[model samples]
Target: MLCVLSLAPFSSPSQSRSRSRSQSRSPFLPNVRCLFGNGKQLQEKRRRHSKADAISTQEVLDLFDQLSTAQNPPPSIYQFNQLFAALVRTRTATDNPVFSLFSRLIQAEGISPNDYTYKIMMDCCARTNQVGLLFGFLGRFLKEGCKTNVVVFSSILKSLCWENRIDEAAIIVLDKMPKMGYAPNVVSYNILIDALCRKGEIEKAMDFLHDMMSKGQEPDVVTYNILIRGLCHNGEIEKAMDYLHDMMSKGREPDVVTYNTLINGLCKNGQIDKAVDCLHDMISKGFEPNIVTYNTLTDGLCKNGEIEIAMDFLHNMVSKGHKPDVVTYNTLIGGLCKKGEIEKAVDFLHDMMSKGREPDVVTYNTLIDGLCKKGEIEKAVDFLHDMTSKGRKPDVVTYSTLIDGLCKKGETEKAVGFLDDMMFNGHKPDVVTYSTLIDGLCKKGETEKAVDFLRIMLGKGLTPNLVTYNSVIHGLSKLGHWKEAFNVFRELVERGFLADDYSYGAFLGSLCKQGQSKVVNKLLDLMIKRGLKPSIFSHTS
Candidate 1:
């Protein structure tokens, strides 16, 4: 739903025609005057009349009827209603009523659909993923002599590509444009190129770039940047670099997007040195690296285990008048955590707060995971408390990590207590939470409590995932309760679970430990029948 509009306005012929008509009529009348003379007295009468005036719905309807009766009529009052419906549909969702209302207005009042009408409906359809309806309406518009311009095509092009209709997008771009008497603008080319790149059609994207020039249409900076970004996105770093070089050779300066695109790709592909070189390349070209550019490079360095250099780049970003946002802090924290720098990660969290940048859920989640991993479960718990005090409630992730941490530390009772508190706080325990707690309980010989929580999770309408089944099965089997474990296994198979590697492995191990060789052989046969091979450990045990 995020849209970026190119700022340069296109002046339509209709506006010019209106202006010409007004100018050809006459200039303002030199001696024009009100019949009621003295302007102050007339203004007073008008104010009194305006204050006393009110119009009934019936009166409004009558006026609309009168207006519609004329040939070449002005729009009726229902025009506003149709517009309102479209606006409402855009916000909430597009339903039948809004479309039905517009169709009715078009039929009943003879109100020809205008550009705004089509644009609004297309936007609604795009938002709701109703591309078929959008295409149908576009066909209607074409039949009605309304041309599909750049904006109209751009809106639906993304939808088509998103829905994996790349063929349709190509047809619209290459075949349909000339047939419809509309030339593809820069925006049109950008859409097609972006779509092709997203679909991994890098060669086709290049072909479109060539086709644009062959058709005598000039490609702008936006067009090249789209292709560059698309190539980079698909990890076609070499191809993206070629396009970047081609753009530079033409004296078309690569903007922030171009540099950022290449830098992000390089960093992501483990070419952090090259990405940094690209950043310096931008500076050489007299183009300043924006915060996004620096963030991408820093994140890449951090991912590459160059944590100190990444921090230095972050400091350089701050010195260059770029304030690090959440993404900046997240990259740093994530990198520090990766290197087992838990204290520094926590310090960064404190720094984020001291600088008035409140840590979002991701920030808290990262810190929580790091702290938990470092066996600082108490600090992680306290972090959650601090989050709540700062009015940022713990999300499912925060609770899940803490619960998992507690479970690992043999604090099953505290983990269960936390789950209860989470439920009371309106954060439902997902399957992962249940699985973690169940695994912890099963290991601690608390099979009955694990079973109880599993039942409650099911009662809450959450189906037990593979991990939940594995935990409970392993728990029951460990307690010499083979019947309950087998029952769970049966229930899982009945629900059409894949009886995946972990589940089969855990079951076979339990059966072996219990000396139930008969059940173990039968389960292995069933696993093979289901085309699931048991793990080596499962077989050897």
Candidate 2:
């Protein structure tokens, strides 16, 4: 028999002890009285039921052994089956201690992992971010003389691209593919195109798309989906819609994902009416709206300040047997935060927690950002402390948002302290983080400190962007350090870093402001020689 304990609340520890003493005085079987007190009977019933339902780990092992030791394996005993069995045993078995059972099977039973088996392993590795293992698996597959097919490689290609292993993925696609009896298919091209688009190289993706069509492979629904999603993500909404229309012209029915992606893009870009119309179109096309469809619509509605409509959609989702997951909650919280409804968002957070769902980092960050926006920095900091107390580590966004808030409040030193704390927390600052800090410093007449941060960024192998240089140049020029600023401008040009109109104008205006007419004319001549046309303002000034 398992012993269970449930302590009841009392006024004080002494009072609880006295109550226990009084209970013991009245009962002949004091332990029994304690066991059956209050809701203990129901707890005991559950305990008994749990014991009855328990299955031993040894029993599960024995059953698997029986299946493995069959006289003849199933006819469909593909290598994929072997790898899949290994994955299942490794990932799912709570009681199974030995995961190397498959290794023993291969050695004793002579069953080897097949091509499909290797593909599944590769795909699994990709999904789990064990992408480094994929190359070794691929090498093993080639050594085994197993042919690689589209079904086998597409998923691997996708995994590589998803993990930002684009260059390595490209080598396999472009150079090694033909030798391995594999040709670029629509899926292959789509993966590359999708990766390019993700990195904001839309022109490169489009060029590759054109090359793909020229190579005699017909683009399919998956191809269109990848392109459409990429275009929409890059804010080319008009072009993305054109692609959607193109899908119809090609007699391809748009899948639920296709509609949801476009609708989400529309909603994110604040085209709520268009998003609503897209929803109607999805319904009119006889395509059933899934949870994603509802959630996207709800998020869009919330973003558009249609909270009532969004809540109604949430209700509709449950009515149709669909339940919102963590993503749904996150999106709603984020939308509400964006609209300055943090109090309502906090209520939703409490509601979610009561329902046994935990708020993730995004949820906390959203609430924290909203609080900071309302100038409730102390409350925001309290929420952050609460997050840490709950054992949730703060990510870059958490630190970045707080730093930005601090900078906005003229708390530069505090912001720097937070930045230092972020480094201590093992989170490297991004470009945006640096930009914000630099801008803040420049505003507070801490130009030298800002330049120092910029140098440190570059020293850490982070690229100094146009914004970094522009900030430094502007700050130096404002301090009447014309020579130093001009030196930077010359270095930027010499390094082939493209300066925007503002940077160009600032540099030219500084020269003109200093009454260095000769140097200004010389700089204009040099600019024209470099094929950069002087703006009318620059020329006149």
Candidate 3:
């Protein structure tokens, strides 16, 4: 039971009692009666949100200034609502500026906010994680009477669903509103279904679908799309496909979204052939595949290790008049790099530029990683310079890749230099970066320096994972620091780090070199006691 205004009621005790008296006089249930509006009408109204859609934050501020200084007639509440909606929807919008603008609007003479105004404010509260203040706005929205705009109540349902208050939203908005002669419509049902699906409540969402149909509210393409997407997301692809059949039997034609969702799901499940067949099926059904459709397929092909096939598919996509975007290029480059085809990946990068498609940070990072893995560190640095020259910033991944290459080549000091340069460039080293450096230092017999770095990482509040702990145990064991190595191993275990085969092997192999045969055998017995089978590497060690 999620509370809409569980934080605290906003109205005064006397005002609440007065409202209670007013509600009791009416024939409706005061406890459950809420504002409900026609969702179809709300959709129609939003379709006309062109002016609000194009309006920016600065333009909204300018409108406010104009409103404040206007001489005779003040601006209409409709105009005020449009500007308010634009401000609330701004991506970079902060709480204070929005509230300040809203506060000034309500205070202005002759400006009375409508359902649209309350809806925008409610959305703002939800977006800013200020749900506690939600009651104040909702109270005002519904204060008009029990029979206000359904759209505002729809906003309440959306807000509640967004907050994962599904049960309360369903009962209060879905079940109760209908008893007051305002049954939830298809749009209302879709909102609840989408919410439930997002929470992985597929069974409950399906129940809502059945209930919606039992009420004779026909499910639209959007409704089925949501169900299909949810089923696919939950790994119930077969069930999702069954819904597609059910939808067609009900005469609702499957749209591009339906096909795309199934294709993506099939690809992820390693059913590439089926994904391609689905694409063909989509084309046969007279639906043109969009850029998203192609990109998803190309990515699928790449992940399946069919790099050449993916490249060919991308070329086909381009020939079909759908230009390859940066994502398509990046995906191909990453696949080629993973397959050790660095030259081909570099060629694609050049080709991408020739086609006026700018390579992003991902493109450069993938290529740099490929070069480093091939021991072409010098070439990798050149590409790094090239990346910076093009005004693209090298992130932690860029620096980390270079550091790893340097460490592998036994250039520990140079790797440390790159770490400094990484910080100087305003990029903080993540745990992976620190771990790479520590591993390199330990491998070079710099035990004291490696320990210092471990302390620095911990001081920075970065928890060292299993890889980090494993590196320390291996290094300390190699240096014949038996006590410290065992202590570190114990610490790793107590920290809930489960040792894998490499964990045991690395430590045993290191000690084996020091002729600790007896110790190694005893350790093997302990490993078996802990339900860990010794790998051949451990037995050989």
lDDT of 1: 0.75
Cα deviation at 506, candidate 1, in Å, is: 3.3
Per-residue lDDT of candidate 1, residues 1-541 (tens digit): 2232212233233443454445433222111122123445434433433421232222323322333343433444334344333243434344433454345446543456666666666766666677777776666666666666777877787678768787888888788776878787777777778778777788888888898889887778898888888887888899889988888788888898888989999998999889988989899988888889988988899889999999899889999999999999998999998888999998998898899888888888898898888889998988899888888889899899999999999999999899989999999888888989988999899999999988998898999988888888878876777778888989998988887877787778778878889989999898899888777967653
Q: Residue by residue across 460-485, what tens digits does model 3's lDDT show?
A: 99989889988888888778786677
Sort order, lDDT high to low? 3, 1, 2
**lDDT, candidates in the order shown:** 0.75, 0.72, 0.78
Q: How far is candidate 3 from the true structure (C-alpha RMSD, Å)?
A: 9.7
- lDDT string, candidate 2, 1-541, tens digits: 1112112332332333444445424311223223223355525533443441242333323323433444444223342253243343334332232223333334434456677666765565555555455566667677788777876577677778878888877777777676777788887888898898889888878887888888787778887888788888889999999999988997977898899989989988999889889988988999889988888888888778788788888888888788777777877787788888888888888887887778888888988999888777888888899889878889999998998888788788988999999999899999888888887887677878888898888778887778878887777777767887888787777768977766766677777778988988887776777677889867443
Which whole-number lDDT from 0 to 100 does residue 229 have in model 2? 85
Q: Would you list the clashing residue pairs of candidate 2?
A: 79-114, 80-117
Q: What are the models' TM-scores?
A: 0.74, 0.61, 0.83
Point out where model 2 deviates above 4 Å.
Answer: 1-106, 109-262, 265-271, 277-288, 303-308, 318-323, 508-514, 527-541
Q: How far off is residue 204 in model 2, in Å?
A: 15
